[model samples]
Target chain A: MTAAIVALGVVVGLLGVLVVGLLRSHADVLRALHDLGICEDDLAAAGTAEGRRTAGRRTTRTTGEIRMVPGVAAPGASSSLGRLVDVSGVDPHGGAVHIGLEGSRGLTLLAFLSSGCGSCLDFWRAFATDEVEQVPGRDTRVVVVTRGPEEESPSEVAALASDRVTTVMSSAAWDDYDVPVSPYFLLVDGSRGVVGEGAGGSWAQVVDLLRKAAADAGLALDDDRPRFTRRDLLVGRDRELRADRELAAAGIEPGSPELYAPLHAAPGDGADGEDGAR
Target chain B: MTDVSSYGITARLPRGWDARIAKRPDPAGDPAGPSTRAAPEEGISTRSAPAEGDPPGPLAGTEHPVAHLANFPLPPVRGDYGSGAVELMRADDIFVALVEFEPEAASTPLFSHRGIPRFGVNDFSPHTMQRTIAGMCGAQAFFNRNGRAFCLYVVLGSHALRAPLVAQVNALLAGLEIDPL
Candidate 1:
C-alpha cells in the first residue's frame, strides 16, 4: 500500500505541471491576439479562441512620456488615478483663490502655459480672442495657468485674461500638477481626477483635446463643425518645416539637437559669452 | 612659416611652433583624448588635472605668465573638426587654443564688431572671417573654410603682453588655409 501511494503522488505532480503549462500557453495566446489589434468583440473572428481580449489599453508614445489615447475606459481607469490635491494660487484679478479642482460642474481644461515657451506664444492670439468664451463642449470650462507674479510675466500672458477664460499664475499649482512642458493640457472631469493629459502647441491642438475629452465622456459637442481642418494640420506641420529651413539657411543643421540647443539661448541671456567693449 | 597639412586642409604654424596631427580612423574610433605628450620646448604635459573642486591647478600659485602646455580634452560639443583633439598652449601668461569644428550647411550669422577692433589678413576676407573679442581675450580670430571652422583663441597673461602676442596670433590665423580635394 505504501509503494502504491508513492506512485500516485508522482502522477499527481506531473498532472499539476501540465495544468500550469496549459494556463501559461493560454495567456500567451491571449497576449498575441491583443498585439494583433483584435478587440474583445472580435476575439472569435479568426476562428481562434472565444475568450475576451485582455483589457490593457494601448499606450501612445509621445515625446518624453507615454500617454493613453482616448478610447473605451480600460479596467480601473478611475481607480488608477489618485485624488487631485488642493493648490493655492493667485487669479488674474489679484484675488487669492484655492484651486481645489472640484467646483467644476463639467469637464475643466487646465492649460499649463509659460510666457517663455515659443509654442505657448503661438496660441496666445487665439486664446485672447472671444472664441475662448465658448470652448466647443457643453458646460466645459478652460483655465489658463501661468507662472505667478504678474509683474514678472510678459505682457502677452497678461493679455490672455478676459471674461471667457480664467487666468491663474501659480507656481504652486504648476508644481502640484507636475507639468514639465508648456502648452500642456490636462482634461479633468468633475472630482474624477485626471481624465487625459497631453501637450499642445496651438489652438487647434487645444480643440483636438476638447474633441477627445468630449468623446470619452460620452458627450457630444453642441457644434457639429470641427475646429481643426486638413489645412490647419498642414499649417502646423509647415511651421516646423519653415523653422528647419531658417536654421539651414544659417548654416546650422536643424537635425543636430545638441548644436541647436546651444545656439538657442533665452532672450537677454546673451548667446555670445562676452559682454560689451570686450 | 611652416605649412602643416591635415584633414584635407593646410594651415601655417607659428614661426617656431610645432603641430602633431591626429587623424580619424576609417572605421570610426573614439574621440581624441589627452594622449599626446608635451613637446620638449613647451616643457609641459597635457595629462595634469587639479584635484576635484580645486581652481585650475597651475594658475593657482603665481600671477606671472607661465609656460604650461596642458592636454585638455575636446569639449563636450563635437565640432566640425574631423578629430575632436584639443590642446591648451599656455606660454608665459598667455593662453592659446587651436580648435576645429564642422560647419553647418546653413551659414552662421556674422556678428557686427561695432565697438571692437577688427583685424585679419587678406586670406580671411573671402571667407567672411573676422577678429572679435572672446571675453577679455588678448585677441580672437574666427574663420571658416572648406566646410570647417577654426577658432584661434588667445588670452594674454597680462595687458602688457597684449602687444607681443597680437602679431603672433594674427600670423597663425593668416596661415590657416583649406586643402581642396
Candidate 2:
C-alpha cells in the first residue's frame, strides 16, 4: 500500500507538469495570433482569419493605453496628415487613369479594398447599393482603390464595381497610403489633406469613425459658409469697371482729390453716415 | 497624365483634372446595355412659354458613348455637355465633353473635319454657351476620326480669360486618341 501511494503521487505530479506545459503553449499561440491582427473574437467567429498573412511585414499597432471608442476603431499607427497626391492606375477596362486629389473642393474617401478579402465584400455591396453615401454625405466623393493587375484581377474588381463609384486598381496608391490591410479607409479633405483614417467592420462603424475624425479635425460637415454665385462675381466686376470708367471720364486719375475726399471727410459727415476720419 | 479609354474613345487627362468614359443607357432598357436610366439634361432649365413645348429628351435617339473631363470634381450625374456640373464651376474651371455618333455620320457635313480640331481663344464665345450663365463661354467642334463621328464641346467659366484656358484645352486635346469602333 505505501508503494502504491507513492506511485500515485508521482503520476499526479507528471499530470500537473503536462497541464502547465499545454497552457503555456496555448498562450504563446494566442500571442502570435494577436501579433498578426487576429483577436479572440475573430477566432471565435470565423475559426480562421480570412486573408491571414502567413509571412510578411506586420503592421505595428499604436502603443500605450488606447482609449477605445464605441463603434469606431482607432486609426492604425501608419496614419498621417498631408495632401494625397494624384492616384494613377489602370481602370477596370485596362486603361490607365489618374485621379487628381489636390485642389479639389470636398472630401475624397479612398477605400482600400481587395476582391479576396471577405470583410471587403460588405463594403463592396454597400457601395453598390449607394449605402456609402450615408457615411460621407453627398459632399464626399468615394473612390475605390484596389491592388494593380499584378496583385489583383481587374475583372474581379470590375465585377465588384458600382457604376456610381469610381474604382481604380493601383498598387502604387496602396504603397503611397501605407495601407496595412484590406477594407481600410482614408478620408481626405481637398483643402485640408487627410483628416481621418481607420478600419471598421461595417458601414455603420465607418460612419461613426469618420464623424469623429472630421470633428476632431475641426471640419463641420454641415458647412454653412456662404458660396459666391457666378452672378455675384459678374456684378462685382461690372461695378468695378463702371467705377473705373466714370472716374476716367471725370478725369479723376489715381491719387485724385475726389477719391481721397471721401476718406478725409469729418466723422459723421460722409454721405453714407459713417466715420470717414479718425 | 493618365489615359482613360472606353468604347473606343481615349483621352489623357492632365494633373488636377478628372475624367470618365461611359456609354449612355439604352432607353428601351436593354439588359445587355450599360444602363437603363434616362439621359440627364444638358443645361439648367428656363421655362419657355408653354407654346414652345418642352425640350426633347437628350438621349431620345440610339445609344452612343460619351466622355467627360473637368478641371474640377465631376459629379456622378451630369449631362453630356455638363448641365449639372457647370453650375459648380469657378472662374478657372473647365469642362470638356466628347460625344460619339454612329459610324455612318462620319461623312456628314457637320462632322466634315477629318481630325480633332485645335481650339483657340476665338473658338470660345459667351453667346455660344448652353445656358447663358454670365462669365461662362462655350465652344463646339464636330469631327470624324477613324470612321467614327465625334463632337468635342468645351465650356470655360470665364470668357474673358479664354486665352490661357483655350491653351489648356488644346493641350488636353493633343493627347486624345480614338480607336476604331
Candidate 3:
C-alpha cells in the first residue's frame, strides 16, 4: 500500500507538469499569432452573430467615449495617422503617376491592400462592385495603393482594380505609411494631414472604423446640410431688422408692457384675480 | 511648391498641381540598334499609325522621355499627350506635356528655339488640339535645350479663360529644368 500511494503521487505530479507544459505551448502559439496581426479572440469572434453584435456595440460605445475625451489617443490607436504624403508610383501600364496630397480639398482615403491576402479579397471585391460608398457629405477620393511592380504582379492588380477608382502601385507609399497589415486604411484631410487610420476585416467594418475615426477627430461626417455662409447670416439679420421695424411702427417698442403681460398674471404677484391666475 | 525630378527632368509643381516623368518604352521585339526611321516633318505627332511592311517607328527617331504636369489629378493611364486625363479636366484646369526628342533633332529647324518658349493667351487655339475638345484650347512649341530637342504642349480647359491659365503655365515653365544627357 505504501508503494502504490507513492506511485500515485508521482503520477499526479507528472500530470500537472504535462498540463503546464501544454498551456505554455498554447500561449506561445497565441503570442506568435498575435505578432502576425491575428488574435485568437478576433478569429473566434469573426464567425458568430453575437460576437458581431457585441463588436458593433463596442465600437459605438468606444467612439462615444473618445468624443468625450478629445486629444487623448485611444488604446491601440494606429501609428499610420498623420504620416501620408504625396503618393507616386508606376501605373500598371508602366506609366509614372504622382498624386499630390497637399492642398487637396476633401478627404483622401488610402486603401493599402495586397493581391494575395485572403482577408483583402473581400475589400477588393467591395471596391470593384461599388458596394462601398464615399464618406457621406465629404468628397472622399479612394486611391487603392498596392506593392510596387517588383513585389506585386501589375496584371493581378489591374484585374483587381476598379475603373472608378485610381490605383497606384507604390511600395514606397506602403513604407511611408508604415502599414502594419494587409488591409489597412488611412483617412487623410488634405488641410489637416491624416485624421484617422485603422485595419478592418470587411468593408462595413472599415466604414464603421473610419466613421468613428472621423468623429473622434471632431469632423462632422454626417453633416451633409448646406453650410451657413455669411450671406445667409446677413439675410437673417435683415429679416430680423424688418420685423423689428414693423413691430415698432405698430407701437410695440422694446419696453412694451404687452411682452410681459403673460408673466404678470401670476398668483404670487396678485396682478389678476385668483381664478384668472389659475 | 513641390520639387519633382526624375530621369534628368525636374519641375516645381505648384499646389493643386502634380507631375510625372517617364521614359518612353522601347518598341516591342526591336533589338538595341540604330533607328532606321526618319524624323517626321512635324516636330511632334500626337498619334502615328503603323505603316504596312515598315518597322515600328520610334517617336522623333528614338525612345525619349515624356513629362506630364497638370493642375488636376492625373490618371494612372494616359497617352503621351494626356488622353485619358485631359477629358476629366474642369473648365479652369491645365495640362502640360514636356516631350523630349532625339539629340540629332535638336539641330533641326523645327527645334531651333533656344529655350523653353513662354506662352500668352493668344498662343492657344481650339484647332491645335490632337482631338478637338469643346471649350478647350491647346498650344505646342518645339525647342532645343542643352543639345536636346523638346516639345511643349499646353492645354487650357477654357479658351476664354486662357489668360490666367497661361500665366500659371508660364510660371510652371519658368521652374522647369532639363539636364544634359
Candidate 4:
C-alpha cells in the first residue's frame, strides 16, 4: 500500500515538471510528439510532463539528418583478383573454418555488410533457405564480409555457416572495395576473371545470380526470389535489422513536411523508411 | 550553344532553368537568420540588440564557390585561372558549385551540363554520368573526360544551369583561369 502511494506521488511530481517546464521553456512539445507518432496518452503517462517533453524533443532532433540514398553514379568496373579478394579475415563467415579462395572453391561471393545493416541481413537470410546447386546462370559458392567484429557472435556465424555463409572480417571491404554502406554484394568469377556486382541490398539477388550461374555450369538448383512479407519485417531471420532500428536516431528531421517525407523514405532509413519515422 | 568557335572569354549559366526553386525563409526577417525564439535549453535572447541592416561579421563577403576559389591556388589540373558566379535561373536560389575537369582527360573539357551526375568522369560518356551529390548540395557536376579538354564542357554548363550555377562556378574557377587551352 505504501509503495502504491509513493508511485502516485512520483507520477504527480513528474506531471508537475512537464507542465511547468513547457510553459517556461516555450518548447513545442506537442508538435514534436505528433511528429514522433507517439500517442498523446503515452506521453502523459511517461511519468512527469518534463519527461515526455524531453523525450519528444530528443526524438525529433534525431530524425532530421536521415535522407534517401543517392542513386548510383555508374555501374562500377567488375573487380579482378586484387580488386575483389582480401585474404585473412577479409571475408569471414562467423566462426567457420577459413578456406582460402585458392581452395577447391576458387570463387567467393564477397558480401559486404555492417553490424547494423538491414539489406545485408535480408540477403543473408534469403540465401540460407534457397538451394545452391541448380541456379540457372550464377555460381553457388559464397563468402561474407562485415565491418563490426564485436557484434558478430559465434552462434550467429555457426548458424549462417551451416548453410555456407563463410564470414570474413575485413576493413578492405570499405577501404579497397568502395562499399560505403552495408549489403554491397560482389560475385567473384575468378577463373573467367569477371566479378559481376549489383544490388547489395538483397541476398536473394545474389542467390538468384548464383543459381543461374551454377546451372550454366551444369549445376542445377531451384532458387527463386524470396518475397518478404510484412510479418518478416518485424522479426526477420537475420539480425541486421539493427541498422534499420539505429537509423531512427538519424532519419526524419523537422522541416517542411512535404519536402521531407520523400527523403525519409529513401535508403539507409531501411526499406522505404518503415521505422514509422518516415 | 551559339557558333562561338573562336570565343576567347570564359562563359557561365544559372541553375533555375531546371531545378525547383525553394522558397526563401519567411519574410519576418532572414529565415536563415537567427530566430528570435531562443532554443528552450539556452534561452539566450539577443533581439534587444542593435537593428542592423544585415547580420554582422565577415559572413557578408564569404559567399559561393567562386569566392573560395579566389584564394585557392591553381589545382594540379586546371585550364585557366579565374572564378565565375553561376546561378540557376530556375531556382533563383543561392548555392555554391565546385567543378573539376577530368583528371585523366584534358584539363580543358567540353559539354552542355544536364542531369544529376551530369557526366561520367572516367568513362567520358556523354551525359550518361548523372548522380546526385551527397553531403553537399543538389546535382553532381562530372565532366566527360574521355579525351576532350575540361573547359569545353564548362562551355556546355554555360548553357545548362541556365545561368546562376555556371556563373557561380566560373566565378570561382575564374581566379585560376589562363588563356583557353
lDDT of 2 at A137: 46
Model with the higher TM-score, candidate 1 or 4: 1
Looking at candidate 2, what is the lDDT of residue A33? 85
In order, what DockQ does each candidate have?
A: 0.02, 0.11, 0.08, 0.01
Give one digit per residue, the lDDT tens place, for model 1 in A1-278.
Answer: 99999999999999999999999999998888676655455544334343323222222211122343342111222222334544345544333333335322345677777776667765566666765654666556577788787433534454454434556677876677776657777777644666766665567766876788667755556756544567976778645654553343223464666474665667644422232232
Candidate number achieving the greatest DockQ relative to the actual structure: 2
Candidate 2: clashing residue pairs, number: 0
lDDT of 3 by residue, B55-132 (tens): 112223225778889876665556666767678876778899887877887887777878878776676888777678
Kindly indicate the candidate among 2 and 3 with the higher DockQ: 2
Residues forming the 10-long window of minimal summed lDDT in candidate 1 chain A: A55-64
| Tens digit of per-residue lDDT, candidate 2, span B100-179 | 77777888776777887777676578766667789989877778999988777788989986765666677678788898
Ranking by TM-score: 2, 3, 1, 4
Task: Provide a comma-separated list of chain B TM-scores, one per candidate.
Answer: 0.44, 0.83, 0.81, 0.20
User: How high is each candidate's TM-score?
Assistant: 0.32, 0.61, 0.57, 0.26
Q: Which portions of model 3 show Cα errors greater than 4 Å?
A: A1-76, A79-84, A89-95, A123-140, A147-165, A169-172, A175-178, A203-278, B23-64, B102-104, B131-135
- Candidate 2, superposed: residue stretches over 4 Å from native: A1-77, A90-97, A128-130, A136-138, A148-160, A226-278, B3-10, B24-33, B36-65, B126-135, B160-163, B179-181
Candidate 1 matches the true fold with a TM-score of 0.32
Question: All models: lDDT?
Answer: 0.44, 0.70, 0.69, 0.34
User: Where does candidate 1 stray beyond 4 Å?
Assistant: A1-83, A150-156, A217-278, B1-181
Model 4, B1-181: lDDT tens per residue? 1110011212221111110101111224442332111111122221221112211111111110111111111111111111121221112222222322323333322223221222211212213212221221222233322332222222222223223333333332332222233
**Reference contacts preserved by each model:** 0.03, 0.21, 0.20, 0.00
In angstroms, the error of model 3 at B37 is 26
